[model samples]
Target: GFQFQMGDGGAFEMMGGGPRRKKPKFPKGVPKDIAKSMNWLKGTEWNWNSWRNVKFDKDGTFDAPTHDCQGGFCRWSASPEGKVYILWGDAGLHELQVQGAMPKEQDQAKMQGLRMKGRRTSDGERCQATFQRVFDFEAAELERDLYGILGLPDDAEEADIKKVYRKLSIKYHPDKNP
Candidate 1:
């Protein structure tokens, strides 16, 4: 029998082992800063753009889907100019997505306003890295309120929704009203 002792005062006995390895010990107490950070991380959200996007309340908590999305809470935005990023935040921003006609793939790269960052941090370094865009909606801010704002039901049909949208658009047109 081979007996090994770990740095944290734990010992383990092994049978027929070539090299002795120490058993890992659990920390007696978590650091206060680390504990606080972990608590905040628990509130962090990673949204997956399935077909139905996530909705948030006034307090920034999850609500419900805005509309009956087809594919899932789908992610269609991108940065070809290599500007958009997935950053680690010390204090995050209120991110939101706007629905519009998607630009051509080349034009998407020039859409520089789509940049995203983790919450602001004064003490940390700004580390940048490039990643192939997959389903990285962790920082996505989706707008799930268009249907609600229009006073339409969540299951409103496309034709009905479009008609309402046009009516509202014309009513709110600055050039026409002014």
Candidate 2:
């Protein structure tokens, strides 16, 4: 059966586009500030009822670790090839984890400026999480080495790697006052 009315005495037969898609983008020349404002407007006033349509706040980030620990399953995880993505919150930083997709160097850089989308869990309750959390430089270096998990070459021997690791550790160690 088709929905006969939109509550405004308007025929609501044949629902519009399917509820799932790549999600819509703002029209051309629409400033981001305006688009965000418009989104807020539609949400706050029109009661577009997106809560029933999409998940809670369709445009939120998914932090798997935070979510898993906090019991919030609305964490988004997307991977293409060896590249993994962990979108944080709408305003939080997006952590891009690139592994050894390339055999050269397993570089891990954290950029703090990116927008994220909302995530949905098995339950209906919604939670918002931000991605940005300042980390000490030493922690970052360890994370960088952990990337790709490929490890250094076997022929290089453990001594070489240890030397490099020590150098990095000294440079970023918090007590070093770097």
Candidate 3:
């Protein structure tokens, strides 16, 4: 038997008690940034209305209820800039354009908070099937030079971007100084 605990920032802490639990190793050749994105996605439940919810796991595996198959496994992937690509057994290929910073290391809690905030509805209100669709369309668009802010080259790896972001956050986050 195994127990899952929600750790700080909404990530699950595995069944271990220690000063520092070991992080799972990603498969070889997977970029750290991509691995981090995948880890954030894994084990997190997603819902599109009440019937189309799914939970992705390691190695891009997921189980979803579909009309044709009753229920079957599926696969998913994310782009560098955070677009989601899904290959459901019945629906063929679907691409989702996610607006905002893509999920990355140490940002799981923040991202989760945003999602929760967006999905809040008054009691007795049914969740809209077009929630994500409407939200993506209505989100305030922004144009920023991300590479310029990070002082990185256009082709910088995800790991490098993360390192710089952590350093900058430590230096500039309001709570850090106060």
Candidate 4:
């Protein structure tokens, strides 16, 4: 017969010597930052709602949610005790454990700069120049293709490029050409 215990210790024993603890499983759509914080909060009182309130205020304060809320979550601020906190429902408060500052890598910085420049430049000539500069910057990053060296489209796939290279190689072979 199966045994069933009945006290606090019994509950642990019934569930194989401890509380029935399963790993926390966040939804697929949860952002990495929120997920990170939530994972850290597992076993504590905090839950998904706590993750939702987290924000990374660039200026050390919370940004308005109505604005361009990048990273798919409202920004947050750090309390005097150095813990991350968010204001909820106009008056409610929630403490969040953010992993790090808002992600502002080099690429993000470039895009931010470009957006600021775009906002400032209203003249058609300036806009055209800006677009051209952006195009040149992006194009410079691409590897020059071997086909492009032979005046073929860079989009030519490996097989096509190889085929063209073989044809050219055979045509230029000295024994066959002379």
Best by TM-score: 3
| Reference-based lDDT, each prediction | 0.33, 0.31, 0.47, 0.34
Question: Which candidate order results from sorting by TM-score in descending order?
Answer: 3, 1, 2, 4
TM-score, candidate number 4 = 0.19
lDDT per residue for candidate 4 within 9-79, as digits (tens), equals 65556676555333222223322232222221111111232222222322323333443333333333332
Q: Top lDDT: which candidate number?
A: 3
RMSD of each: 16.8, 17.2, 17.8, 18.4
Q: What is the lDDT of candidate 4?
A: 0.34
Per-residue lDDT of candidate 2, residues 5-90 (tens digit):
54664446456654532322323332222122112111111111133111212232222323231333332333332222222333
lDDT of 1 by residue, 1-178 (tens): 9999765643433434556433222222311121211111111222323333232222223322443222222111123321222211222222222223322321223433322232223344343222113232332223234577699998999999999989989999999998
Estimate, for each residue in 1-178, the C-alpha lDDT of model 3 and write its tens digit.
Answer: 9989755753345434645323232233423232333345544556655456555444565445664323434565655555455555544444454445545432334555323212212223223221111112111112234686689998999999999999999998999888
- TM-score for candidate 1, residues paired by index: 0.24
Candidates 1 and 4 compared by TM-score, better number: 1
Sliding window of 10 residues with minimal summed lDDT for model 1:
30-39
Could you arrange the candidates by lDDT from highest to lowest?
3, 4, 1, 2
Instruction: At residue 164, give the lDDT of candidate 2.
Output: 71
